[model samples]
Target: MMWREKEQVLMFTFTFVIYAVCTIILFNIMYRTQPTPYMDEIFHIPQTQSYCKGNFTKWDPKITTPPGLYLSTVGVLVPLAQWLGWEVCEVYFLRLTNVFFVFGNFYLLYCLLLNLHPQISESKLLLSCLNLSIFPLTYFFVFLYYTDVGNLFFFLLMYTFHLQGQDLVAALFGVMAVFFRQTSIIWVFFVSMAAESSVYITMKRTKLEKKSSSLQFLKKFISTTAALPVHHKKQFVNVLIDILDTCGGYLLTAVGFIVFLYRNKGFALGDKDAHVLCFNVSQVCYFLGFVLVFCSPFLLSPGKVKKFISFCIKEWVLTAAVTAVMILVLEYLVQIHPYLLADNRHLTFYVWQRFLGRNSLLSCAFIPVYIFSGWTVLQTLQHKDSVWQLLYILCLVLSVVPQKLLEFRYFIIPYVLFRLNIQVNSYIQLFLEFSIYVFVNAFTLVLFLNKPFYWEGQSEIQRIMW
Candidate 1:
């Protein structure tokens, strides 16, 4: 174990050297061509500058999320920048904060996989961690002033701590994550329940022992107890106590969120009008399809495709059920928020115009794609306990189902969470994933840098981004 841990360090260092070289190259491009705040960086950079300058009272109304990003920037990186003789308030320097966040995220993801998949080889874990770090949706913002990477840092930190059985520390970071984005509160409770489920599912295998999750696990354990006669009613009590212990801190975090809701009257601190809640179940389909495409390199390989086909044929009923449900979701629940229609500078706008939203038939044609994507993604998690799988589906629904907009950044955490848990067949699969990320990211950055266009009535040139 010690030698493998050392090997992991070596792997992390090797991966870091590659990622760091790429980040520096991207940073130079941004510095030379797009040094000023672009897009949402306009809001994020200025607000963080305010916090850095010790103006705590100033806030950006256009910023819907809380001040966690600003607080973290000012609290840690800002001072570090000063000590390093860097300009703490420059847009370029502020963007540098997330550059460092990239490093931190890489290490945190390494620790997370360490705790979650100790049986895996050091090299495989490194690839999974590095692949997620460079995932196109999240990686594009690494050289920009964005909260997505920073918030994800906290999210990964929270889950890593939870996996290590440091539940209270995990819960604290969960609150910090909520402070970064209101939607992150969903994952906060998700980590809580997932941790609880881990304890219950792994309980036998300690005794081996939620509403949906808790109640379902209880029913199974009760039935299994009746048959096995090892974990009795008394042992069940012990399992329940352990579950409560695991989830208690996150429950407090939820209470704090409730109190904020009661006092503030809603989830968003500002710009509630734009961030209004909606039941756009279509977003979930789009996300699943996005995940499928990214994972297609491995998942669409000949052997995997054959397996998928076999499963579909043998379990035709299940395949039909998934297809039918997707049909309903696409037909009635598809939504197109105004931003998607208006923002030509975003990749989603073109995606909507060209593929999914070009016509009703074109959109509905994606139902099969959604089903295949969803099935293959679920197949990756097949080795997990039934409760873990169930809770994962439930959490993805809660996280993805309510978005009123069609932003791919919202897909980042869910994709990372899903990708990290899946099995990899070979080094070739990991290489394929890395190859895809390189192609997409290289194309994206080249487009953004060389293909600048001016928006009507706006002075600064605009570049498309994910």
Candidate 2:
């Protein structure tokens, strides 16, 4: 046992070292290729630099996000920048802050996998870490001064602590995640739900085990109180009490988020026009396509998918009703908000215009795509009835549905959560997934570095390019 434990440690060390080295190489390539600020960094870098100079009150009027990123730099990196006496390098130093957080995220993820699945082999754990490293945005964001990585790091930390049953610590991290990015409230909700659900499931299972016979268990499963003995009723009441206790931390965190939002003036600070709550069917289709692309490897087994669909078919009517209601509600909500209907500057807007030729009729073609996407999410939820699984699917769908704007970066957390839920059984599958990630990363990196003709007339080129 001792020898095996040592071997496991060595394997993990080797895998992590390789990940760090490759990440450094990629970061360097991206930094050297385009050292200047790109896209959002145009606002981010200046705002962060202001923080470095101890000007907390002066924020860039154009930058809408919270000051979490800048504040974090001022707290840690600013002192280092002063020590190095590097003027121009300060910006690069700020960008490099994410590099450390990237490594921190990897370490947290490794720890999380261990805690969540102690039975997992060291080799498999290493492969999982590698899978995380290859996630395009993981490397891509490291090159820019963005809140995505920082928020992700805290999000993972929240999950890691939650799995360890440190509820208060988990809640604290959740609050930090929201501070980094407003959308991270989704994670707070997920963590809370996961904790509550886990407690309920465990208590329910224990109570079921105490029942005298299989028939009683079946009866309890079919109907909550039907045929349940008097003793089980007392146990059910106790389970509800336990669930409330377990959820205290999450409730505290939720309150904190509400307070923070209230103090900050609203949920987000950026140009509200850039993102509106609008019902865009095509955007939903694009989001589905995005998920399919990122999660293609796990979704490869048609047999498993068919089985999930077959199981869900029994509730087909209910599912259809819920989906239709959700779509209609979202459509109605979109018009109630003041949002830009058309922004050619956004990549999604540009693509739709080019392919659909600005014709409203072409939009109808995406109806089937939206249906398939909704079914895919429903199937995933049916496949795993765990609290975490349900929350993951809900957050993934919710994050995309209300947004008028679309960006690949928006899906990073969802992708990470999805990948965590999947069990990669073979080296071949891991290799295939890794290869696809690398190809996509390379393709996107090239486009970002060498602005192609298609990128012309885009706001990104005008504002972000050096």
Candidate 3:
């Protein structure tokens, strides 16, 4: 009956309600369209059916997805069909494996949250919703009947192992993830190597016994440069500008050095010169990686720097960028293109119908989502959570593929969860984010349903589900 006790009870109820609402919404979306067989479902069902029927070659040998998924898929399908006196290709039964795997991933994510934050707060609830509401993850994998669900399961398990200090087990899982889809491993691995090196550098440096403030660093740098002899002042400024420009090419663009210096002033790590150095190094690595991923095309050239940038662009670069632009542009153009004098409709139809297609667009949108998912990878790196850092980095490295890559579901799951955890500090910011999320997801859901069915009537299995 005490006021404090009442407050505690109220908080508990509020958190529980938000969590329940998110969970229900996720499951409802996942299951409502369950009966619709996506194009990939045709491939998955046939492979699973063949495996259950003991026709090993029924699955594609060229399909080098992880062996664990194959074994588990078979295990789930074979025994259940016989016990229930249903065919392996049975529609409801066929999608069971995917549904189970999807839910299993959610449970794994919950466990991860529990481990990372033993005592949950409202932020935890918000983070949980942000993570679980990942439109791309569920949108791409759950309905498509792809190996992403299983791949994601293993990827999360890998993180769990690392968090639990089981490095060897995590490495094994990391390897399996690569086998599922090579690109997933590549993303995680790059982060791991980069973070490990950072920690090592941090360990070697002496810790600061007394830290100075950011204002102090700025004051000292400004006063020192200002007081320098007239000749040295310009030289010092030029040197500073050169350092920034040579480093990331970011200094030459937009607000450049001023903006960077201002941002780094806060991230300056007080008076610990060593910590400051290490932090700068880590920031450079992350910023470079980010720039390389997002804005590489702007910097492309034949030189060593540009070559490296081009290499980082990867084959999916065009697909990913174009897809994001197309989504934002398509609605506007769909009505006007047909009326254009040049028969722009023909051009649009050719591009959408024959070339890019719906499935390809899904894959393309999935790439940006997966890349954004790496926002968590950056946060984990900053926190220097060694276990997570290691697993995530390794996964990033091993999962990379050069072209037409679509099956990195494992990395996608952690990427989303990690991103959600990297929220800014404010109620207003959170509300704005939630509003944008609602609008985008609503639009995406509509887009997903309205697209022509690609798998229907493809085969007997397709009829039941697609």
Candidate 4:
């Protein structure tokens, strides 16, 4: 048994090393092809360079993100650069730093997958790792000086510690995640739920040994209530109570988030106009559409789709209530920054303005899509039926729905988590997924490398707007 375990470890190591080498080569190719600063790097690179110069107090006014990334660079590369007396190519060094984190992110993801599904085959594990490394939006960030990769790393670390039952360590990593990217504060609830789920599962399993009557009663009650007519007041109340019991942590987290925003003087930072929340139903559709596209591989199975639809039908009231609440929250209550809408160079902006006519009809048209997204999320929760998984899905939905800006990169962690939770059983399915993944990344990379655009009258820049 030990030998078999050793063999598995050796195989995983060999596969990871190969993927890492290929990723490094790909990064180098992209770097050589387009070495200039692009997108947010316009601010990220310059700020990091300032850090290299020992101007710790200096910050780029245009960079809204916290100084974690810059401070990290200063802590690591500044010393190395000083030791080597090399002051040039600071941007490249920063990108290199991201490259290191990129590798770390991949490894941590692999560890996470293993912890989540210990019975997974080596071949399947390798495929999962490859899928993450080549995930279109995430792959693009590897060659840039962005905090996205680091955010993913810390987020995965939090999950890793959670899986190991190290709740405090996981919370610490969750704090790191939030510091790196303020949006990551959602993980506080996610981590809390995960720990709570672990306890719940353990207690339930222990109770199973004694055939606890409460467990039996709860199960029978749920099954009975699920079968009752929707118009039944008792049934409705029971279902509502069940949902609240399951989701109470999320409600508490929401309150904490409000407190956080109050303390921070509002959720928007740096460019306040660029990140506010507002009633933007189209943004929710856009993000959900992205989720569908990203997860099309898993959704392709007829059985899975049928299962998801059945789950929605089974819990129609819960599903409808959640979906309605989501839409209402997004439309009337949320604040929107509309960063993508502000940038005219991207496809999303034109889609909203020109194709969609910026009308309510467009929002109404995507109602089914929104319902489908909600169903998919609920299906994920039901499959796991764990407090942590439910909380994670809630947090993910909350994070994206309120944003007026739509970016594929924002969905990275959720995408990874979703993919991990899904089971891909067929080689044909795997091949199709790999094909789509490669095609998407290749197309995006080529478009990013060759497309010409101007930002603020700076001519001939090759950058992806989102």
Candidate 5:
């Protein structure tokens, strides 16, 4: 057993090392020229400089993200650069901090995959590791001097803990990730329910397996139905007990009941459960925190029943929900605490416009990337017959809508979640795997080419005969 554990660790470490090296090389190629980092990067450097100069007051507002990365930036890199007689203004060193975090992100992803798919064989594990290395958009964000790098790491870390049945740890990590980028908080809503649902599925399967040998149990229900006598033979009480044996199973059973019945569409037993009151309470807490931003008021106010009806019946309910939340949050913040908008702004369309307009070529390139990405996630969720897939779809819609309303940066975390969703078939699996490799390498090559990376001669290409 000890030897087996060591072997697993060795494999994980080996995979991590290879992936990290390849990622760093790709990033080095991409950011070689211009080297102009984002404004947020510049903002952080000044904060760190203030801290190093024994001035901590101005640093407080900039500490929206956790102190872990900031401390390292100030204590290690800033000091080293100063000692080497180098100017602190060099953006390369600040970007270098993200280089290291990218590996840490990979490690977290590996650990999360392991936790979620522990039953997978060694060969599949290696394949999954390679999958991480070749993930298409990972290169773009992983090497940037942006909070997304750190947020992605902690996001996966919390997800890993959730997969391991550590909900509290997952919640904490998720909260931290959202603090770095508040829009990511919506993911916490979906993931928590999904994790709970997954847990329930596992437990139900286990109980069914444990009871498989019992034949007499079917005799009682034989009179009620023919083909599924065994299914009908069981009482709701007995099934409920089996579900109650584990928290996850109970939620799943409830979700099944709520989702399957047309009258209860979008409702799950888990949603109705008193125990889930705690989760709702957590949402309320998040709403309150962002209250100055507008979300809290809408949730608190018993808005007109017509709006709720519209939200429910809308074809794009997920999109509508996100927009409504954005309006609610933004309006409240503007009204009550306009001062917050003076310095640290919240939920503006400015970010989205900048991403698409400023990064037009790369944004266009990302279209195929996201298409393949959405295709993969949809295929995966469609593989299962359970109502949970509907919830997953809603979540996907919610993820995309924010990018439409606010900024393209909002799409980053959602896109990551979509990609991380498993593939339902070999076709999707192979396509994603191949696309990640080809796109990353191609993007790198494009950046390295002497000419501009923009399209030059699409109409001039000749088709080769098969």
Candidate 6:
């Protein structure tokens, strides 16, 4: 067993070395192909460069997120660039900051997976870490000056620390994550619930059964907490301490966030008009479909499909009711944002035009797909803590349901969180997932590099991305 562990470590070393070299090569070609900052970089690069030059007062009104990305560049990456003699604030070098973040995020994910699944196979954890680091939505930002990579790093970091019982440190990182993206405050609350609910459930393990009524369950839960002496009283106390520490820290940060919201007048830092919350019911459905496709290795199987078919037959009435509700929601409440229609440069445009929005019937046809994906998503969480699953569903709905835009990039964090929680014991399935991810990455990267086209009136060469 000891030798097997060593072999796994050595294998990871080899795989990581190859992966790093290839990543550098691909990033090199990307930089060479488009020396100028493209798309969002047009806003991000200049703003960051200003901060690098000690011009902290400079602000980009069109940029919606906070100054966390730029501040990190000034505070950390610039000093590292000096040590390595790389040009400080050079566009290519500035973008290379994300490469550093990519490696760090991979290591954090490996640690997180091990923490979450200590008894799971080490080889499986390593593969999950590597594959998630290259997940296309997050991966595309690795070679560009974008906030997504850094935001993800801190997010995984925050959750890792929380799960490892470092509540104070977890809260610190959670605050940093909020700086990266305001929506992360929602996740801070999520981990807090997961922490407190975990202890409560652990204290009441055998006594609280699912058969009880909601009133009975409530009484049992309250009584269980009141009767902590039934278990290790000291253990329960320690957990309470941790929970309180986390909540206290988060509340301080939450206050700051509320103040920002009040002062800024809304969530979006700069572009308020474009980021309004709307009743986009199909948004969550679209996200679930993304999970089904991207998570095919874990979710798609003949056995599961056959079982779902049988279950559907048994639960036909339930399924029909769900489908009917979804169809009505899609028909009446699906709001087509002007950007999705006006922007032909985005992949969402074609997807909306040719597939989902082709006609009324075709759009409603996807209701069943949405239902199946939702089922698979819940199945992935079935083994997790019951409270955590409820929290997960609530947090996911809050994160994606109100988004007025159809950008898949918005779903990256939830996807990563979902992907990390699933158990994959089969080598065949893991490798198949890795293979498919590689294929998609290769295709998308090649398409972006080789298929530059001129937008109708814009002079900058346009390349498609998630």
Query: What would the per-residue lDDT of candidate 4 be over residues 127-220, giving only the tens digit for each residue?
Result: 7777876777777778888888888888888788777866667767776677678777776666655554433433342332323343464465
Candidate 5 deviant stretches above 4 angstroms: 1-7, 26-40, 51-56, 59-90, 197-379, 383-388, 404-409, 423-435, 448-466
lDDT per prediction? 0.80, 0.67, 0.45, 0.68, 0.48, 0.82
Q: Go through the candidates in order and give the C-alpha RMSD of each one to the true structure.
A: 4.0, 5.6, 17.6, 7.5, 16.1, 3.8
Of 3 and 5, the candidate ahead on TM-score is 5
- TM-score for candidate 2, residues paired by index: 0.78
How would you encode candidate 6's per-residue C-alpha lDDT over 357-392 as one tens digit per residue?
889899888877788888877877777765667678
Select the stronger candidate by lDDT from 2 and 6: 6
Q: Write the per-residue lDDT of candidate 2 for residues 1-466, one digit (tens) a residue.
A: 9999899888888888988888788778777876778667889988888777777788676776678788877788756656876563355778888988888988888887777557777877878777786687767787788898899999999888887788778888887887787788887788776653443454465554423343454455546544334547776666556666676677777787788768866555766555545555444555666666676666546775676467558778865675565455444432311212344333444554554334444544544445555566545544444444545656766776666555656777877876676665677777777888888778767766675343546543431121
Q: Spell out the clash pairs found in candidate 1.
A: 203-206, 203-207, 203-208, 203-209, 204-207, 204-208, 204-209, 210-213, 210-214
Stretches off by above 4 angstroms in model 2 are 82-89, 196-247, 276-285, 302-351, 354-383, 452-466
Clashing pairs in 2: 64-270
Residue-pair clash count for candidate 6: 0
List model 3 lDDT by residue over 12-86, tens digit each. 456546645654465456546556554445455666666777887554533444344556777777777679886
Tens-digit lDDT track of model 5 for 1-466 = 9998899788877877777777677667656743654435556656655766667666444333434455555667766866898765356666677777677776666666566556666546566556654544454555556676766776787677777776666767766665455444556656665655432443353333213222332342233224222564454444445435434432443344344445523222221331111111111212222221211111222343344445446646664554455444333321212222232222222322353224435334333223223333343444443334544555645554322122234444554554455532233444456564566446545543333322245432221000
Error of 1 at 168 (Å): 1.0
Ranking 3 against 6 by lDDT, winner: 6
User: The CA-based lDDT of model 6 is what?
Assistant: 0.82
Estimate, for each residue in 1-466, the C-alpha lDDT of model 1 and write its tens digit.
8996687678789889988997888887877788788888788888888888789998888888888878887888666877997766787777877888888899998887777787878788888888888988878888888889888999999998888778889999999988888788888877776654434543543454333454577677556656533645665566556656677788889899999999878767888888777888888889888988898765676776787789889999988887777777787788778899998999999999999889878888887778777777777787776566766788788887787889888887888888778777688888999999989999898899889888789787889888
- Candidate order by TM-score, decreasing, is 6, 1, 2, 4, 5, 3
Instruction: Flag the better candidate by TM-score, 2 or 6.
Output: 6
**TM value for model 3:** 0.49
The TM-score leader among the candidates is: 6
